[model samples]
Target: MGEEEQEDEMVTCKTNREKEEKEDDAIATEAAAAAPYCYPTLRFDIPPYRSYHFYQQFRNASNPNNFLKSVNWSPDGSCFLTSSEDNTLRKFNLPDCVDTTQEDTCSSSLEDPYVADLIVNEGESVYDYCWYPYMSASDPTTCVFASTTRDHPIHLWDAITGQLRGTYRAYDAMDEITAAFSTAFNPSGTKIFGGYNKSLRIFDIHRPGRDFEQYSTLQGNKEGQPGIISAIAFCPSHTGMFATGSYSQTTAIYSENNMELLYLLHGQEGGVTHVQFSKDGNFLYTGGRKDPYILCWDIRNTVSIVYKLYRSSELTNQRILFDIEPSGRHLGTGGQVCCIFC
Candidate 1:
């Protein structure tokens, strides 16, 4: 073919490619517009009303004092899991017709507006529990959670059927079984990170057994984060980093790739009970046992305490928990007091 003919064909091909690219962009834009992200709006000026109550569900007839210890919502927001003093983990599914905006949407006369759909009785007291990061109600295989209890191996339970899916065991140097103090799934949901006495263990989710990679939080000369690890949290941005809170009143950040200690934070008045990353993963919030303030630290600088959030938990030894909202604007905390602070 002549040179002019070849040039014309090249121009025609370029035009078609541009047209296809424009169509692809239009499709993506339309898809985004159809289901745009929505953030929740919370009002702090008015007193929050109770949307649901569950006094009857948690009450134990025999014990008469069974109460909830901690509560966590599933990753998909479809349900919530609660650990109670009765050595049981209960899963409560949110009702489809319930509306929080209305005062009397559900049965107002009922003492318990919701009941646990499933319950798993642990052999001992539950230390920590976390849902799989990728868990969804639409996917049965991904609908699972991991829990660590006293004198028991880490158990992965099916949220739908309330069955034990698998167990991840850790053995002490004496060849005896050891239980983790806290457990959490990595951001990828491919591995489970367990907190122990001055050490951390990583277990492959696909292989549930005694096999794991252990790393000591203490270095030579015994100068590192010591005491039992109380909590673990991963960065939401997938930065290959995580934070661990210890009973030694210290919180440390470590690299997920090599498990190397990155930074150690001090100034907690009591043993650190919970550590959480902000929605953007640039800051970390930590709450301690008997500590009324939740300290927020700028992970980037780590020079001094950024700010402290006050909660009514100075007199109790319970682990007061706090979490950042999805919008990263407001923070809510639970304490020993009757009221929840936001």
Candidate 2:
């Protein structure tokens, strides 16, 4: 029972411990090696109707700590803006986009550092927004965006410098801004269209301090049945074509000049939170709150079926539609796990 026996036992215990540790390390290494190579990591699949890449995900770091409510891409498609219920707007750079890859993380770069900045800090809820049209190359203004707040006002700012360019408030003729959900600029950047709770208003941004004109009134629905017009979008390619979606699951395209409803396509299963047109104005994208999906409508066809992504999944719930890239390359959805669909 002596000293030699004790030393032998101690040596055996140490060896066993080291062996077990090595085994654990080997298992971990194998799992890491086998982890799927998810490029873009935004869309589940790729190619044809499946190809998509992750641009980036963002969150609010200001007061109230609410999730983002809206987003818009720059006219040049180089940057995008995200507005939040917390009353702040953020601008993110749209760096060179890469196609989705099916390689493992180790084969490609694990992470690429693309950065976005906080350009404006308006102290109110930012419900809707849009980037201004770029008219001339020599224009000093890099980008322009409008943020509509609960205070019944629209604040325009130089997206690049965060300088306040103009403020459009409601007059007596126009009822108090019930809910401003979406904003848009005509292709030439001369006019601004805003969709509100009970009506739609257009502004002349070319002239500073100009008042907004009430273009059309949206049909209201019964309480708790979707009365609020939540989103609006102007067609980039179709000069006078615009679209509006509300909580009642209806998305209607209209003529910007006469405010005439051109067509109403119904596919949203929940509140139609937002709608967007592709750069060519061939397809209209709508975001649904109840079903929580992104629906693509073929504008050319009279009753084309809706193409949707992420139907009723956890990632799609409460996902609000923001802006699309100027080239119509990507659409941004706001939520805890914000998404960019190509």
Candidate 3:
């Protein structure tokens, strides 16, 4: 064959091979893309309860006096912890009850929480309290609870025994110590986060660290009117997702791994004092000092607000308390309201 003719043939062969390769790759890509996606849908089927019919007025002795600031239930849902302006962190225990086996044999019903114990002392005004993770299976029944106070310090106490575990002094360089508003434990229970003033400081709880040996610095809003991050909560399902609310009347969903801002939730009227994720991590609830309403948002759809529970009104402000069951079935709010869903 002539040289030029052979060269042209060779080029044609190469182009055909390339075209075939491209076609094969396109087919493979489409096949992979067409694979069915599977995401577990959270079932929220339990019916809702009206504010009146759900929870009775828990006028138990352990109830915090004045403004009941924060509440946290134990891991097993056997008890609940609360901190209030009344200057105490108390533990209310579930009434003793036999397991299903014994219940079936005896034909008795399950018990409820009562004024079982006083976990913390009566002097310091506890602004927030968080139960330690993995508390149920711990060696002793003395689970840890972090109580942040206007006393310019965070006190870690044994929820069962009421013994002081450790005290984290407020950083002196920050001028006046603001009220420690919100406290939370990392999912692993190795670290604790305290929200105050303009800083969200993380501390090493297990190693017994000094005052606020902060490993991460999170500053939201800006100077002139630095937004005080009033409420902070770690995601219950995914370790990397967390939510923070501030005095600027905004809530930011951020990544815990790199602290990257994911979404900023707004439309509230006042500073957010508390933010929490539903047990399944599908929804977020936020409320605060001036906001007498609990705002619920769908995490997947950032722009959608699921519901709002009016905690107070013009005639007389009603203090609404709230809690979520571990099973994610029941949401108990203040003023005797419990919401249930599948």
Candidate 4:
């Protein structure tokens, strides 16, 4: 009610607030001093990648709204290609790769976060992106990638300059264009293969449409012809062999020369979405829709799987991709909601 009383109350409230702030600061300082130092985060129990450091992060201002769709590593392990939903690819170079090396992949310095060195933008929304089987950042000509978009021609581009190198087009009997979901390059980089709804189309790089080969991977016509292929992985050893995984939970190895079905390894728990071969080309690893484990098979012996690498916990229809290290000892893959390494 009085001015003097109001002023005294205001001063007391200020004093209490300052006292609380000082107490909070003291508690935080004491907690920090009592905590123990943590070692650099790594997996010593793992084979080759016992030590992995978070070197950097990369962001692009050009396509801020698009989510990451796919990632493909270079053959030489120098750099990688990250594809976004906008039908664009970004090449994030590992600048410190020259002086460092890792047991599994080429190492980059733990300097400032790396930035996108080059951005390759195509006009259509990208369906799939694959690095040339022999891409190397050191050689500009060798730094190439293949991409496919729905209802659009498959284009191969120079990753360094983002220039269109070649286009592999497909036309139906009506002379209308056809769409594809997945693309791959032969180990020699002389041919391109695409996954259509029910078949895989092989194209010669020089003249894509002049003469092409088609192979059907559809196993069942009864289940509403769920014949769409999930992914394809080519053998890097040049053994004239490649593998195709489909929605029917079968992984088939095919002869590259005659396009003959060599062998079939079936009975996976889920629809095979992605397949990859080990560095030695002696084993194949596969991840499927709703599968909790990454299946590994010995190519030479198809009767039994070598092991099942554990992955994310859930039932998902999403197709996850996995990769093996250059040393052939470590394995990496992504799950529905997280990344897994085995």
Candidate 5:
């Protein structure tokens, strides 16, 4: 080959090699820059639950029909109760903080929460169950729980004796019984509230047959907002304030004085089935049916969501509910599939 042509060919080859090297370096740099943003992961620094007081089992070999539906702790924190699909409510007593017995039941995972305390089962199927707001083991006579049934009256049962204490009903003048989907007692335990399709009713605890007052859940007929409060919670310290979550995917705060709407908190893609205020009453956590995220909002600043935690994904066939620890150190929900402690 001619010297000039050979020299030109060698130079071209060297230039092409240098171009390929530059392209490779550029590709590597681009990937490094996109790594952190494209696939962001959820991280948490939640404290581990030091001890598991007890695990309440829902089902056993002989009792395979016990599917857990909901659980709630007493106002005094002395005990908690669970409602199951088998149409029964069971209470589990928690050991005192000073218990000398070793808490070998302690676990950080979602093990079968099996416990033995008390059981009250007499209903077709449970729609909702709650402990009386002032329920304390110290007062056995007054320590009771109330539940609503799809085809039965709202029965307030003595938690200690496993006997029916009272029954609240929402009936018409013609004496036709109505269905109650959810029920809760006022903070003072003087009155009971039942939630129906789009209405919330209040009845005197002494006389449970008729509602003293009925209030619609909608605010000024605001279209496409929270409807049919699936859950209701009253602040322990702030008796004048309470919150309700609806099937329309909204959580609302209201004042008890006049039952006036105070502040509305909205950020759920599915119907909110659970809502709870922290011990301090400054923050709230909400989760909904078919939604995997539990959103935490600051009542003081409701402009933006401050934090969020996830449970199972939308594919799961269960409605997930979350609860904060008594110490406020950790958060908990159903299913270990996608639930995080932090």
Candidate 6:
């Protein structure tokens, strides 16, 4: 009960408080380590400068008019794949480091660090291509992409070596080869969904051959999406649902489990060319060939269009694709006018 006893009690309390603070700091560090990596938000107010650019490699002497058709980034963001008019798929790996603050400058093919690292030539023009949903550069086996080309079966190409890994063939009723207009890997990356004329085919990723389960998009009563399917996008939230855009100007949502038509979206001025689901998978955005507007629809309520995002498209038959950013707060798209809309 003296002054020394009281001072001893206060020292003990201080030590205990310091120990608890250290424990709290350790817990916070562990939690941060367990959290997934997040990409920094982009600033649009300031004009963005290009860190890398490439040209000359895409040129073809035999086909002087060859041009890039579409570019898709890998799921891991390690690289990107490009399809071109020359019936070739090229993979370009991103550099390990870049000086974003440096002034923008043009670089020739020889000087460009973003030159194509791998290229796979197809027999015909590519119709659609998509990276494996679970692709990771660290895993060699998972680094592959599926591409559909004219008059050719769906090819699973190795992203690292540019080799033909596998093929999924679909035969017509008369036992002839049938090519898919669009192809995409399911959320699990265990199956590939392919779109054909008034039909959809599901192929097992492991077993690559003519074997497939076909579903007629056009039902027996003729109450379904008609014409060739142009694009396929799966729900990002692993909801076992996907949206298909058709050349018939109809966008249809289907249940991945049974290929059941959930809803049909109509309003595209031309044939639908692209369909992407929001990161939350609650909304769907669709773009069409020669269509100036990208229609947004709420899957929860398909009765009315939620809104329309306009782009400079309407004149070209080429597919003008748009994508929702990872944060789902912004959407970016390229149009025929050579400008990107965000």
Top candidate on lDDT is 1
* Model 4 C-alpha lDDT per residue in residues 297-326, reported as the tens digit of each score: 998999988888788834667667777665
Clashing pairs in 6: none
Clashing pairs in 5: 55-113, 55-114, 56-113, 56-114, 57-113, 57-114
TM-scores of the models, in the given order?
0.86, 0.63, 0.65, 0.72, 0.73, 0.84
Greater-TM-score candidate between 3 and 6: 6
What is the C-alpha lDDT profile of model 6 across 31-97, one tens digit per residue? 9999986766677777656655555777757777888778899999999998888888889888788
For every candidate structure, what is the RMSD over all alpha carbons to the true structure, in angstroms?
A: 4.4, 21.9, 9.5, 23.7, 18.8, 6.3
- How far residue 139's Cα lies from its native spot in candidate 5, in Å, is 2.1
lDDT of each: 0.90, 0.66, 0.66, 0.76, 0.76, 0.88
lDDT of candidate 5 over 1-342, digit per residue (tens)? 999999999999999999999999999999998785333333456544345533346666767766767777888888888877777787878755554565544575567444658988765878788877766678776788888887787888888888787777777457787767777888888888787767777888888565568887765766333477778888756657888888888887878888887777778878888888887788888888888788898877888888888777555535567777766556778854735464
When 5 and 6 are scored with TM-score, the better candidate is 6
Candidate 1, run of 10 with poorest lDDT: 333-342
Question: Which regions of candidate 2 deviate over 4 angstroms?
Answer: 1-71, 92-118, 135-138, 172-179, 207-210, 218-226, 304-306, 313-319, 322-342
Number of the top-ranking candidate, with TM-score as the measure? 1
The 10-residue segment of model 3 with minimum total lDDT is 48-57
For candidate 3, the TM-score is 0.65
What tens-digit string does per-residue lDDT give for candidate 1 at 115-195? 899999999999999999999999999999999999999999999999899999999989888999999998888999999
| CA deviation > 4 Å runs, candidate 1 | 1-41, 47-50, 99-108, 338-342
Candidate 6: deviation at residue 146, Å? 0.7
| lDDT of prediction 6 | 0.88
lDDT at 271, model 5: 85
Two-way TM-score contest, 1 vs 5, winner: 1
CA lDDT of 255 in candidate 3?
Answer: 78
For model 2, how big is the CA root-mean-square deviation?
A: 21.9
